[model samples]
Target: MVLRIHFTAEDLLGTRFADGPAPLLELELAVAMRRRRDPDPAFARRHRSLAAPAARAIAPLNELVPATGAGPFFLDPLSAGLEDGLELVRRATRTAVRGELDRICRNGLPVTPLLRGLAHEDRQAWQQLERSLRAAHTALVDPVWPQLRAGFDTDLAWRGQVQREQGLRGMLAGLYPGSRWLGSTLEIAVAKQVEVRLEGGGVLLLPSAQWTGEPLCGPLPDGSLLLLYPALTPLPHLYLAERAPAPGADPDEPVAALLGRTRSAVLRLTLREPTTGQLARELGISPASASEHARALRRAGLVTTARAGRAVRHSCTPLGHRLIAAAGTPARQA
Candidate 1:
């Protein structure tokens, strides 16, 4: 069970990961996982109170996304946000929708009256789809979006660091559990055998909080190699909720209490291994304060400080990396 993707020089040069998770993709996969009865224990336990209500809310579209399909089906014309994604679906020409449905059905027949009449009465189908999508997102994702968004940003930042420090090859090598980078080729462990050769379309790596198992790779309508892989920092909803501060509490107060704001900022700023002076300047605090914080971090085994002649450097230790990762993602931008 191996899927091999051969990349060219141009493809290697252009391949890049997505900045953050797409709401529609997460919704699609989360719903698919539910349909197949693949329950994520942590997710289930945490969202249990709301699971039943959420399921009932989106029950209308259960038939459309059956537990079984002819093959993996991608949402047509991908979009990042909920409304934008639905807009793309709605804007898709009836012919495009029908062809996609045909492929998914694999029987050359419509799966439902809405699908059957999609060529003629698409507005109704689109409306139903949008309704279900909104309900599902509100019930399943909105409550936990802040944590989810932070998880995504943290993972993306780590990936960027890997790329900068170890090159693109290192980034790809760390991408998936059963995937490896061998020069220009990426060997994937998959149930279905697949062989793809990239032809200047590059690659889009999407980290999904809802995904589990091996990465799913395929060609998009635009002919790009899109790989949907599980996020490395997949913080469970239960875990996040437990750590979340009480309502009306300042979120930063907890960490700030644990480590004074100056020291905490110094440690986080050193995630990039800056000089004590550089860190001090960045935090707008005195260089002595930064040095003191670095020493404290070193004592706590959260960071390592080393000297290169007259120049001293500060970098995060494994424990420090873990701490930052556990802190959750940064604010997201559109």
Candidate 2:
């Protein structure tokens, strides 16, 4: 089956990629994927690793989002970050919470204690749900977050490159698995048939590291549709524990030697497409130092720096991607 997204001219103009992956959405999808049996060996291995604490960390979430059917959209609030999203969930009104839970239950999902308490606006239930989300994120997301961020950056860079070279339609056609850009409409492959009219509401495209299934289409808080799919840039190392660096060997030594450790580190971080301040914070350096390093890379044609509003964003150039790839880095796909 396919999901047809009809678009207007304004919708076409407004459609764009999100700034980065949505942490809350990714967390929910990761939890959902972890519960199922996947064919990938890496996912299987990772699933097995979480088999012990997985139930306690993720069981309550099933009430909010059962094994099937739509869950409460409030769970994946469109916010600045995970904590902010969780706060939104915490602050969801009683009516909204009850309405969504009632809707889910109507779909045949059982009324668990969490769901019942949430439906009744119970404070303790909210706290328990929030704790489960935090614990699940710490277990499943924190370990691979940096790598996921890097991979997302690589995919965003690629999408930008595609749009530059192939126009909006071309980029949209290859945006996700089985996506077809058919003039006024974009079609996406899914298990069920559905149609969405983007009557100037546009759309937000988000890539996922954990969701290996078909594309997911849902509404954002702002009424814009969100299309979530597996990230295009492959970072197999994130899923494979054996891919870790061997004992006592510095995997980055070659790149560090070539570009010097600090500069090389800066180059690698550019894959996350961070701003000067973000780079500074991540590298524990002053903004001045980060700017200098970025400037050096830009001068060497290994990085591209762009000014967005007041912030200067740094991204890897194709040459920079090749150099990082040669160094066997997790980010930067060539």
Candidate 3:
């Protein structure tokens, strides 16, 4: 059970990371996570709580992106944004739609009226799908978009450094679990064994916030490979309640009393490894104030700060986490 990707020198030269997170691809993974997959219990519970509205909304997509197996190529259309991607899906030709539906059936998914209508390019069915996609994005993606964006920025910065210092092979080696970079071939362990020839088309690396599974690779509409991997940071923020806390709520009083209120909040914010500016924006403090607190925490070994591009990213160190735990702060769900 392995997926071997054969790459030529030209393919390596052409390999690149995506510009940012793909909303539609995230939606697909969100649907898949809900559908027959094992995920971290904390993540699963949080996802279910957040995705309740999207569960029904994603019905039209279930047949295409099943709990397992191949889905339609048009699903990840290499678009830069959600609306653009949806528009691309909306314009999928009847022949293309029918071909994909037939492929799904061949993979053992039953054909239903929705699939049938989509196969025939029914106008009402496409409309329903568009609405459903919009709903899913709003429910599952919109709430934590800022967090997603921050995570994306940090991942790209770190990956760029990896690419610069370790070259393409090193970047691929650390991408996902069960993957190895062996000379000209990238092998990934999976349930099914298959070989892919890049043929100089290269690969587009897409980091996903919601995809907790093993890496997935497939061809995009443009004949290039799309490799989706979990983002570098785990999204405990996703496990948080959607509602803002009631005014004057102090969940971190134990830690706050020890570290003072502002510093305590800063510590929790660093759990997601926000940039200095992002921390400032999140706490309504100046960047200098944020940096000062971060420096203090770093000096105390409570957090670690690293320069990523022009921004400095801060993350809670092991000691910081233990301190938060000892103080009995909720910190994050997991």
Candidate 4:
């Protein structure tokens, strides 16, 4: 079924994309996907690795969001926002928690015993909820966060360009095939039939790497939208680690001649845009030495660097991407 989202003048003005993914929301979605017996092998591997802790981590949350579907009754309070630190969860308020729980019960949805007690503002329930979120982060997200954050950063850059040149109407129309802009109305393909009249309330479009396909759409208390959509295209390389060079790119010829072996290795490692510190640790090079090479490559226009959050990140430019793909012959013996 299609969810028809009607936008008012104010909503059109207020509608904007989210800055990035919400870790907690992503976790919730991941757990939901697991429950449904996800078919994709890539997602299956990631889910299997979390099997031990994930079940325990997801027990409480499963009440809030089932594997196959979610009702709006409890979704909003669980947003936990986009705070990279998971601060929204740490500061989860009892008042807000109580209201959402009350609403869920009123809506006649099933709730776990733990969720029942939480409506009474039980400290134990709150603490357990907090711990589950944190544990899930450590077990499921921490190992992959650097790559996740990098994906988010890159996706935002692409979206910014799309919105700036084409405008909101254009962005909505071009976002993905599952969604289309029908004049003032925006229709999203979803299993549930929902028609929301967004009276100029803001719409937060979140691009998630975790939710493999389709999109999740909901409304917030503030009358804003929470649209979480999987990336339309396979994001650069979400499930795969970027290789430094083509498998047979010779390490001793062509471009390698210009940068020397050590420096050559540095340039190729940047295909994934690792931070200066990360790159150094990976290559066993000193930070100072890595920085020097980064600067040299930046000057040569073969690579570029940007400050992403606390890390000064480096990435190969298109020129560099092409150069590396065409470089190196293979290990040549003496």
Instruction: Point out the worst 10-residue segment of candidate 4 by lDDT.
Output: 232-241
Write down the TM-score for model 4. 0.62
Clashing pairs for predicted structure model 4, backbone only: 10-200, 11-200, 249-328, 250-328, 250-329, 250-330
- Candidate 1 residue 229 Cα shift, in angstroms, is 0.7
lDDT of 2 by residue, 1-334 (tens): 8889899999888888888777777777766665555423446567577756766777788767744325677787766678888888888888878887887788777888888788787789888988998888788777787767765775676567667766898777766644787778889777779999986889898876566666777877687888876664323333331244322335446555444456667778888889999988877768876787687567445688899999999999876776666566655432
Q: Each candidate's lDDT (Cα)?
A: 0.64, 0.71, 0.71, 0.63
* Cα distance off (Å), candidate 4, residue 183: 2.5
lDDT of 1 by residue, 1-334 (tens): 8878899988888798776677766766666556555545545555456667677877755545544322224342356677787777667665666666776566333377756655465577667767887898887667767656765665576567667866887678667644677777889777667788899998998876665545776677777888877665443631343464323334464333334445556657777788988987786757765676676566445678889788799987765665555556331211
What is the alpha-carbon lDDT for the whole of candidate 4?
Answer: 0.63
For model 3, the stretches where C-alpha displacement exceeds 4 angstroms are 50-54, 237-334
The ten-residue window of minimal lDDT in model 2 covers: 233-242
- What shift in Å separates residue 27 of candidate 2 from its native position after superposition? 1.0
- The digit string of per-residue lDDT tens for model 4 on 142-211 reads 6666555555664465556456756778666545554778888988777768788776677888876555
What lDDT does model 2 reach? 0.71
Superposed by TM-score, candidate 3 places the C-alpha of residue 68 at a distance from the truth, in angstroms, of: 3.5
Supply the TM-score for candidate 1: 0.65
Q: Give the backbone clash total of model 4.
A: 6
The local lDDT score (0 to 100) that residue 298 gets in candidate 1 is 68
